[model samples]
Target: MTLAFTCKKCDTRNIYKISRVAYYQGIVICTCSGCQSRHLIADNKGLLDFPEFGRNIEDYMESQGESVQRLVLSNTGVSTQDSSTRLSPDDSGNES
Candidate 1:
Protein backbone atom coordinates (compact mmCIF):
# COMPACT_ATOMS: atom_id res chain seq x y z
CA MET A 1 0.00 0.00 0.00
CA THR A 2 1.01 3.58 -0.65
CA LEU A 3 0.76 6.26 1.99
CA ALA A 4 0.68 9.93 1.16
CA PHE A 5 1.51 13.05 3.17
CA THR A 6 2.51 16.66 2.79
CA CYS A 7 5.99 17.89 3.67
CA LYS A 8 5.71 20.32 6.56
CA LYS A 9 8.82 22.30 5.63
CA CYS A 10 8.31 22.70 1.89
CA ASP A 11 4.57 22.22 1.70
CA THR A 12 4.93 19.57 -1.00
CA ARG A 13 2.83 16.42 -1.21
CA ASN A 14 4.71 13.14 -1.00
CA ILE A 15 3.90 9.44 -1.41
CA TYR A 16 5.67 6.65 0.43
CA LYS A 17 5.63 2.96 -0.36
CA ILE A 18 4.44 1.09 2.72
CA SER A 19 5.89 -2.39 2.95
CA ARG A 20 6.63 -5.23 5.33
CA VAL A 21 9.65 -3.34 6.54
CA ALA A 22 7.38 -0.67 7.92
CA TYR A 23 5.50 -3.24 10.00
CA TYR A 24 8.75 -4.63 11.38
CA GLN A 25 10.16 -1.19 12.05
CA GLY A 26 7.08 -0.12 14.04
CA ILE A 27 7.79 3.48 13.13
CA VAL A 28 8.77 4.42 9.61
CA ILE A 29 10.88 7.47 8.97
CA CYS A 30 10.45 9.06 5.55
CA THR A 31 12.47 11.74 3.81
CA CYS A 32 10.75 14.28 1.65
CA SER A 33 11.55 14.02 -2.06
CA GLY A 34 11.11 17.76 -2.46
CA CYS A 35 12.94 19.16 0.58
CA GLN A 36 14.75 16.10 1.90
CA SER A 37 13.24 16.73 5.34
CA ARG A 38 12.64 13.69 7.54
CA HIS A 39 9.28 12.65 8.98
CA LEU A 40 8.02 9.82 11.12
CA ILE A 41 5.35 7.27 10.22
CA ALA A 42 3.62 5.74 13.18
CA ASP A 43 2.24 2.23 13.25
CA ASN A 44 -0.87 3.72 14.78
CA LYS A 45 -2.31 7.25 14.56
CA GLY A 46 -1.67 7.44 10.82
CA LEU A 47 -4.66 9.72 10.56
CA LEU A 48 -2.94 12.18 12.87
CA ASP A 49 0.37 11.83 11.07
CA PHE A 50 -1.25 12.55 7.73
CA PRO A 51 -4.61 14.19 8.13
CA GLU A 52 -5.44 14.84 4.45
CA PHE A 53 -3.86 11.67 3.13
CA GLY A 54 -6.90 9.44 3.46
CA ARG A 55 -9.17 12.06 2.02
CA ASN A 56 -6.99 12.35 -1.05
CA ILE A 57 -7.14 8.60 -1.54
CA GLU A 58 -10.91 8.66 -1.14
CA ASP A 59 -11.29 11.24 -3.87
CA TYR A 60 -9.21 9.27 -6.36
CA MET A 61 -11.08 6.05 -5.71
CA GLU A 62 -14.46 7.69 -6.17
CA SER A 63 -13.33 9.14 -9.51
CA GLN A 64 -12.50 5.60 -10.64
CA GLY A 65 -15.85 4.26 -9.39
CA GLU A 66 -14.34 2.34 -6.51
CA SER A 67 -15.76 2.12 -3.01
CA VAL A 68 -13.45 3.14 -0.21
CA GLN A 69 -13.64 3.14 3.55
CA ARG A 70 -13.72 6.53 5.19
CA LEU A 71 -11.28 7.36 7.93
CA VAL A 72 -11.94 10.21 10.37
CA LEU A 73 -8.58 11.73 11.21
CA SER A 74 -9.01 15.12 12.73
CA ASN A 75 -10.95 15.93 15.90
CA THR A 76 -9.87 19.51 16.52
CA GLY A 77 -11.69 22.03 14.37
CA VAL A 78 -8.69 24.36 14.53
CA SER A 79 -8.42 26.78 11.66
CA THR A 80 -5.32 26.85 9.50
CA GLN A 81 -6.21 30.11 7.84
CA ASP A 82 -5.15 32.22 10.82
CA SER A 83 -1.81 30.50 11.04
CA SER A 84 -1.20 30.94 7.33
CA THR A 85 -1.75 34.66 7.65
CA ARG A 86 0.79 35.22 10.41
CA LEU A 87 3.79 37.34 9.50
CA SER A 88 7.22 35.83 9.34
CA PRO A 89 9.88 37.00 11.79
CA ASP A 90 11.55 38.98 9.02
CA ASP A 91 8.34 40.78 8.10
CA SER A 92 8.19 44.52 8.69
CA GLY A 93 4.55 44.30 9.84
CA ASN A 94 3.43 46.04 6.70
CA GLU A 95 0.77 44.68 4.39
CA SER A 96 0.78 45.84 0.81
Candidate 2:
Protein backbone atom coordinates (compact mmCIF):
# COMPACT_ATOMS: atom_id res chain seq x y z
CA MET A 1 0.00 0.00 0.00
CA THR A 2 1.05 3.61 -0.54
CA LEU A 3 0.35 6.69 1.57
CA ALA A 4 0.14 10.12 -0.04
CA PHE A 5 0.60 13.56 1.56
CA THR A 6 1.62 17.03 0.47
CA CYS A 7 4.99 18.43 1.33
CA LYS A 8 4.75 21.32 3.78
CA LYS A 9 7.82 23.10 2.47
CA CYS A 10 7.28 22.77 -1.26
CA ASP A 11 3.75 21.47 -1.46
CA THR A 12 4.77 18.44 -3.44
CA ARG A 13 2.81 15.22 -3.37
CA ASN A 14 4.88 12.62 -1.50
CA ILE A 15 3.97 8.97 -1.82
CA TYR A 16 5.21 6.28 0.54
CA LYS A 17 5.09 2.54 -0.04
CA ILE A 18 4.13 1.32 3.40
CA SER A 19 1.69 -1.14 4.85
CA ARG A 20 -1.51 -0.02 6.52
CA VAL A 21 -0.15 -1.02 9.92
CA ALA A 22 2.90 1.20 9.51
CA TYR A 23 0.72 4.13 8.50
CA TYR A 24 -1.06 4.03 11.85
CA GLN A 25 2.05 4.24 13.95
CA GLY A 26 2.53 6.68 16.81
CA ILE A 27 4.72 8.75 14.52
CA VAL A 28 5.70 8.78 10.82
CA ILE A 29 8.47 10.74 9.16
CA CYS A 30 8.52 11.65 5.46
CA THR A 31 11.17 13.55 3.56
CA CYS A 32 10.01 15.77 0.74
CA SER A 33 11.52 15.02 -2.64
CA GLY A 34 11.04 18.54 -3.98
CA CYS A 35 12.63 20.53 -1.18
CA GLN A 36 14.12 17.68 0.87
CA SER A 37 12.41 18.90 4.04
CA ARG A 38 11.51 16.43 6.77
CA HIS A 39 7.87 16.12 7.86
CA LEU A 40 6.55 14.68 11.10
CA ILE A 41 3.19 13.02 11.51
CA ALA A 42 2.17 12.02 14.96
CA ASP A 43 -0.64 10.42 16.93
CA ASN A 44 -1.73 13.00 19.49
CA LYS A 45 -3.12 10.56 22.02
CA GLY A 46 -5.15 8.65 19.40
CA LEU A 47 -5.56 11.67 17.17
CA LEU A 48 -3.58 10.90 14.00
CA ASP A 49 -2.31 14.16 12.55
CA PHE A 50 0.33 15.68 10.29
CA PRO A 51 2.08 18.79 11.49
CA GLU A 52 2.30 21.85 9.25
CA PHE A 53 5.41 23.48 7.87
CA GLY A 54 7.90 25.34 10.07
CA ARG A 55 6.98 23.19 13.07
CA ASN A 56 10.51 21.83 13.45
CA ILE A 57 9.42 18.28 12.73
CA GLU A 58 12.93 17.10 12.00
CA ASP A 59 14.24 18.50 15.25
CA TYR A 60 11.72 16.42 17.17
CA MET A 61 12.60 13.26 15.21
CA GLU A 62 16.30 13.76 15.78
CA SER A 63 15.58 13.91 19.47
CA GLN A 64 13.63 10.61 19.29
CA GLY A 65 16.56 8.79 17.66
CA GLU A 66 16.07 5.03 17.05
CA SER A 67 12.81 5.05 18.96
CA VAL A 68 11.18 6.33 15.76
CA GLN A 69 11.44 4.78 12.34
CA ARG A 70 12.01 7.21 9.46
CA LEU A 71 10.04 6.46 6.33
CA VAL A 72 11.48 8.27 3.31
CA LEU A 73 8.93 8.33 0.52
CA SER A 74 9.43 8.97 -3.20
CA ASN A 75 7.64 11.39 -5.50
CA THR A 76 5.53 9.94 -8.31
CA GLY A 77 5.93 13.10 -10.42
CA VAL A 78 7.21 16.65 -10.59
CA SER A 79 5.84 19.22 -8.15
CA THR A 80 4.04 22.38 -9.16
CA GLN A 81 4.20 24.79 -6.27
CA ASP A 82 0.93 25.21 -4.44
CA SER A 83 0.42 28.85 -3.55
CA SER A 84 -1.99 27.97 -0.81
CA THR A 85 0.63 25.91 1.06
CA ARG A 86 4.04 27.32 0.32
CA LEU A 87 6.46 27.80 3.22
CA SER A 88 7.80 31.30 2.85
CA PRO A 89 9.17 33.41 5.64
CA ASP A 90 7.93 36.49 3.87
CA ASP A 91 4.33 37.69 4.08
CA SER A 92 2.05 35.41 2.00
CA GLY A 93 5.14 34.15 0.12
CA ASN A 94 3.03 33.28 -2.89
CA GLU A 95 5.11 32.44 -5.93
CA SER A 96 3.63 33.47 -9.23
Candidate with best lDDT: 1
TM-score of 1: 0.40
* Pairs of colliding residues, candidate 2: none
Candidate 1 lDDT by residue in tens digits, 29-81: 68899999876554343534564333344443566686644222234422234
Against the true structure, what is every candidate's RMSD? 15.5, 13.3
Off by over 4 Å in 2: 44-96
Local accuracy of candidate 2 as per-residue lDDT tens digits, 39-82: 66544334434343222333445665623233332343322233
TM-score of each: 0.40, 0.38
Task: Identify the candidate with maximal TM-score.
Answer: 1
Candidate 2, which ten residues in sequence have the lowest lDDT sum? 77-86
**What root-mean-square deviation over C-alphas does model 1 reach?**
15.5
